[model samples]
Target: MKHLASNLYYLRTRNGYTQEELANHLFLTHQTISNHETGKTEPDFSIIQKYADFYHISAEDLLLNDLSKKEKNSRIIFDSVIFDKRDKVFIIISGTKGTYSYKNIKKCEILNEKARYKGKEEPFTHQVVTGVDWLVQANILEQPFYVGLRLTMKDGTHLAIYTSKQPTRTQTDFHIRDVKEAEKIKELIDKIIMKYKNDESYKMDNVNSKNIFFDKDRQTFQILSGSKGIYPMKDVCKCQIVFEDAKYYGKTKPFSHRLLISSFESFFVTLRDTYVGLEIELKNKEKLYVYVSNIKQKHHSDAFKADVKVAETLKKYFKTIITGNKTMKDE
Candidate 1:
């Protein structure tokens, strides 16, 4: 295995940074940086974080084993094996999803037809399927498709196969089918967006009461209760708007919704300039709210104002907004 220390040394050297220069940037001693690069010592977690932050790279990339030379050498050998038994195996697997059964069928029937159609001689070796089955059952090979299989050789060479007379047809068929299906899904999504835009329940009865609206067609869940004004189903993160003219927004990353809720909590503490309690409801169920005491002080009010300013700064990054209050439940 290629060593990470060597890779780190190479990266630092390629960047033209001396050990002392790197150490100064990471807040470490020059000796420590040298030791890490020479494999004499490993850096601690804190130091690792500093190194990652300095490089703007994920820690996993820095810590993983280096295989650059080995990969290059293997690729050259695998490429030159013009009529190797493994090449035929790759041809069979690449035509189908990585599945042992499908590969067997293709090698027996499909391979002959493909060879004749292409005017190429029959591949010299064909019994490699037994070896492939053994490798798969031993857990050395990962099966990624029911009709296709991805084979990873011991040397790290990889091949894929799909089970079709015209293997390339699989991708084309999938794309055409997806386009047809998306049209149907889009119709249902449009209804949801319409509901949210028309829903009366989402309208603010009292600005103090927090509310959440769900648009099923659009697959959007919107929360509208605060001075920041109508935040569209897409803006909040829990949901997204896929169709351009839908009633409710659609759902995307759930973590973004949680992040928005956290932002709201911060908004309540800072922007409203009041210590009054705030409650959050999802799907008509009371989920979360916060109560803060000591609303009388000028400093406390200023803190709330500061919180709003912070929220406004962050708000620039998110642009989607809720335009109308239509409820999905009603539709």
Candidate 2:
């Protein structure tokens, strides 16, 4: 409030906007802009919010905060907007035939959480918590300029956070108006990530001596069992983890899913799953199914399955990186 006039003039000039241009952008007359800058008048709270949003700063900071201090951080709250939790996030993937799609989260789940947090945290955060389960339970392992997360359900269903590079397209948006605040938020996030990592249940991943680890440098998913090759994640169409009576494969077994890579026409195994099946549509429009069961073929060839993790990772990487279909795809 103390620097309202000064801040307005400074920000206008700093952004290379004339008083007339700024007024036009704000749908106001130049005289009004001049009046505000000259301290003859003040903008209403709504107009103040618009100015803050245009400048990518917080309204609170724009009104009452001093920004000239030589502080250690300059992080600014860019934006924060309310989102309706009851609404469903729709995914539309079109093929030559039509489309394959599903809601990102079930409505019942959102309603339950919404009711649970009626007077508590933001309703939208509940969806984030459900998808990125670690957010509420873990400490930050790392924070980057841009981050993406994949949340896989028990039945191979999954969701991706910010699958597209565009921030406007993402589900959640929040900004801190100061660098020090950003650092503090990062510290808090790191603590949450660490909490999840420390959880005993977090250790149950399908990794072992025989498991093929995803190689970041090579951009491939490869585990050497009887094979000596790496597989790129992009080409995978689908994957599955099969199951049989008492014997389970790929960590817990029946809960797993299989993967099919479009470019990898030949059948191969990159990791150890109970049963691995690749479904490919031939150029002739014929469907081919290749099944691999464990290190040995004896158990049940048709029963190759994929776990939620493997299926989710492969499918997500395929859709986001390879297919380039985050929102909608036209065949």
Candidate 3:
């Protein structure tokens, strides 16, 4: 670790490898390499050996001696043993590593380049197409084809890697054509998300209004004081939020058809901007709407634009959650 950083940097430049090029050779991300070169972070012992192996040097020399000077006694070290036992998966975007765990993937989007062009029926009208749609449209105005992968990790790392010469909306490029491969990976990740979504103990808890949340593992949906039901995720057709009244559940009881709604006290009123309305539509065309909870807000104060962000996130979360569950049943 003493001369490791400087030595790596020196050897990479001596071998005419840019940080990214060296990173590719090492099967690591450019950021990780940059951190190592700049002494901001250290690599694992196994990773250090990879660097040594790449440059045909010993790890001891790589970490202790200054390679820029004459190395009269240095010898190469080679080991073929595999040590790590954990079952892991890795995707090389270009040459950088896309480290992911099934449980840690938040979103996997296959980004096929989008284009807008004049329609056949109306030259003055514009139509938009995405992904492989251009293969069918075959319009002259179609832009150069580009397809890429975008994934958001649970740790907040958003990675976008492209197989084409150009990226979708980011700069991570591989200059290789692997659009089909990207689509397959996205499908695999979607399954991972679905599998985790149904965990009985998995709950967003404070992330959204708890007045309505599903116990996915048990296939149960609950409400604060309105009504509760146990139905499979496949039965959920849709859901909506009502942000108009504070005591919306009291004013308009939801899902009272067969649910046992309990009489509960009302505290504060909810507003359109503040959010609290949760309406779930079942496959049978029945709807259930209610305010989040009487005392859902942590503080009683004037509503700000930022105050609504959490609710907005919850709305998106529910949409994807239900959509994922619905697709599983359909398949």
Candidate 4:
């Protein structure tokens, strides 16, 4: 802690604040600020932590490094914060949202909405794995400068990490202290997302080649069969996966088939003929329908039907994604 007193003096003076002002910000008496800067009194661990947090640098770095040197304190935010993981490229930037690898991640986007870190006032929030791909950058412009990035995992656990500390929830949005740095981070993340998201290796295989994929976390349905299309999960007012194996038209008969879907358990569905469609009703009252016409199954009579109960877990997962109201039975 040899450099602690000098560092404290430099930080306060560098910010152009009087001892009393710094004291007020830290909720301490002016004498404590003076004593610490003068090296008359040393702060304990808890007080040291407060100082490190206020300055937005790691406590260890503040303690060991000579921050008063121009190059020492002039750290590039990304260089100091980001570290590579494994043989893969550097993807996740550790912050309030915790470090996460891009591959395991479902999406990341800018969220301009200002709110308390769903956890604490500090910037560090959830997540700590690191990997790549897919980003949904949202620039919410309620005001001039309250921007944040909403990073979500595949499992639906999400968090919005803003650049600097914001006021408590009751007030309107305001500019965060390090907004410019935050924006650069956002752009950097977006670039990484674009690079890996389209790579053939990162995406999951299509659903039976129907060109449709369901994002369980986002609760949204996408159809990439022809052109790209997206629909929010809540917009899905109707859904059914029907099985159709046989159809008799006046003079012809269709054979029966078994459809097998691998999940937590393997099971088969036998249907003479079935139709599966997902319907969406948009805010503009427009209707969109996506039908699964790719499944073709025919099987012998000896094939056994799957246990319908096995679908319950998946059912609940999807239900949590869509289903707006409390409904008849609560999940």
Candidate 5:
């Protein structure tokens, strides 16, 4: 076999180190270093690794002369480390999440595909397939980066490749409206009630429920529910009236609704003002509106104007509104 003794001798001389000095640095006997330089004996792998580290050269370079065809093939094994199927996909996960979350796909793609061959195919898919194939050919599924592939193909159909295991979840923190925003909503509700007070045509029942819709961008609120059911502030007083079907009211009798505000920071109110009995629904914990009487009332233009004004006043204070049955958190 060829030997690297000449190359070793050259490197030692080039670095201004004698045989004894090189031996001392490598923790080998001076005679062993002399034998290595003269090609009398080959050094063990541990010594070769140490020599590579000491000279800042690769083991492959130091042992290149001594490597036979079989040895050369062995070097190929080191070209790429074998990884499992699961490990291959784990690499793909980095680029996907980085692209989606940070909007940094350009950087991620460049870094990830550096060692990969250039092609027109999707860069991530190519990296994944290459990794998988490398693992499979080397029979290294048990290795740390190993992954399995189930591929299907037939005439006149696109190929299908399936991967196992879901990607890991990425955690993120988001800011939410604070208690101050909640207080602002409450203040807006109060203003709407005050603005519509004492209008006979307004149909303010003993149980009056108010729904506040919040405009987050504008930092304001709008009233959503009323005797006419649900109406926007802009249409509250105009000729544009969108009537709500009286489904909450039962058939054939007078109904009375009751509003119940709970101490748990939630609201419940019931709608019962037609043929149905008293049914309750929650408006808000601090405030609620319920229809308490079955008195039939007519809609007046002035009353409509008053309702619109109340909604307009409230619109300056709240953000996003939801109306539905309320349930206590612990309950």
Candidate 6:
């Protein structure tokens, strides 16, 4: 046992392997390697052979030889195997093939296959860490392109990795092993990015009122009670946008259309199904719901509808704010 333990540590360090790298090489966990090196656990005979093979030596030689003699003279090898894995920031990005780490990535760039840009031309670029918003893996209907995963920044910058192509199939390859894994990776990355957004303190000019707007103009369309005031887009948080049936089961209430902001209580937006809206939660736990009205439509007789111009104006403002502040905090 002592011989095996000592040899494990000696061989690992002699090969210049971190616990993680060693685990990857042996198809084992880091904790497993740590345990073996510390003499806290033992590997089966099969695992012994695997490690022996990885080191390009016979199992008998590995178990019998006194490795200390070689350890004294052996030089550590810091080869590309360990460095290659370390260099990547993401093991997978939004359900894609390659691992992308933030290590040396200067910026995220967008690519359009259908665009008639000049040869070898790419679209906009955003800083890899701070400028990226959350990782997105969604399917858009009737679109010529299939974006496997997208990184949308707070400022509306986007970087998308294309999904696998199935010429006969109309949809993107959502079932690929790597694509599925990338979806899970996207969730993890988003949670991490959201953590940074939540950590930072962003103050709103006023939290007393929840106003809904449509276009870029700062117009107040609909205002809810108990709000501090209308907060700018940067102060918004993740919110649930719910669209209810106007006449579900049978007749419905006047304000059947609703938008729920989790961060704010007693505050929501009443909108027609076609209305545009924005919901945000700030670091301080305040929530806002903004509804941009449809110019062509009107609210039910009993319900109130925001002004058409106001709706369009607020909509534009929210879109800009959401895009500009997609992921405000640094990665």
Considering every candidate listed, which one attains the maximal TM-score?
3
User: Residues 177-246, candidate 5, lDDT per residue (tens digit)?
Assistant: 2222223333432332332231222332321234444332222234333322332221121111121213
Residues 54-118, model 6: lDDT tens digits: 76556876787777674333321111111121111333222222323332232332332321221
In terms of lDDT, which candidate is strongest?
3
Per-residue C-alpha lDDT of model 3 across residues 1-331, encoded as one tens digit per residue = 7888998887665444678877776789999999999999999999998887665456888998877664422211111111110111233333123333445567877654432321122221232244365545434443444455556777976555444444232222332335555655566557756666564233466455455666643445665545564455555667754443333434445423222112342343221223344567777887655445444332234443334455565566566657655544443
Model 5 misplacement above 4 A: 65-331
Candidate-wise lDDT, in order: 0.35, 0.39, 0.52, 0.47, 0.33, 0.43
List the lowest-lDDT window of 10 residues for candidate 3: 76-85
Between candidates 3 and 5, the TM-score winner: 3
lDDT tens digits by residue: candidate 4, 1-331: 8888988987666444678877888999999999998889999999999998776556786677677674333322452133222212222232342334443456666444433333454322432111121121222222222345666666877645555354322123433335455567666556545534443232334233344666634446676532248866544443333233334211221112323333342234433333233334454566554433433223322221221221232233334333432220121
Poorest lDDT segment (10 consecutive residues) of candidate 1: 79-88
Between prediction 2 and prediction 6, which has the larger lDDT? 6
Predict model 1's lDDT versus the native: 0.35
TM-score of 6: 0.23
TM-score of each: 0.24, 0.25, 0.31, 0.27, 0.20, 0.23
For model 6, state the Cα shift of residue 111 in Å: 34
Give candidate 2 regions above 4 Å deviation: 68-331
**Order of models, best TM-score first:** 3, 4, 2, 1, 6, 5
lDDT of 1 by residue, 1-331 (tens): 1366776686565344678877777778899888888888987777766765554344665677463342333221211011111111111212321212111221111111222222122221121222336355223432221122233333434333323223122224642343343333334334533433344334333222233444433434344422223322432322221111011112322122221222335544333323322232333342332222223222235654443343332222222222322222122
Model 2 worst lDDT window (10 residues): 91-100
TM-score: model 5 vs. ground truth: 0.20
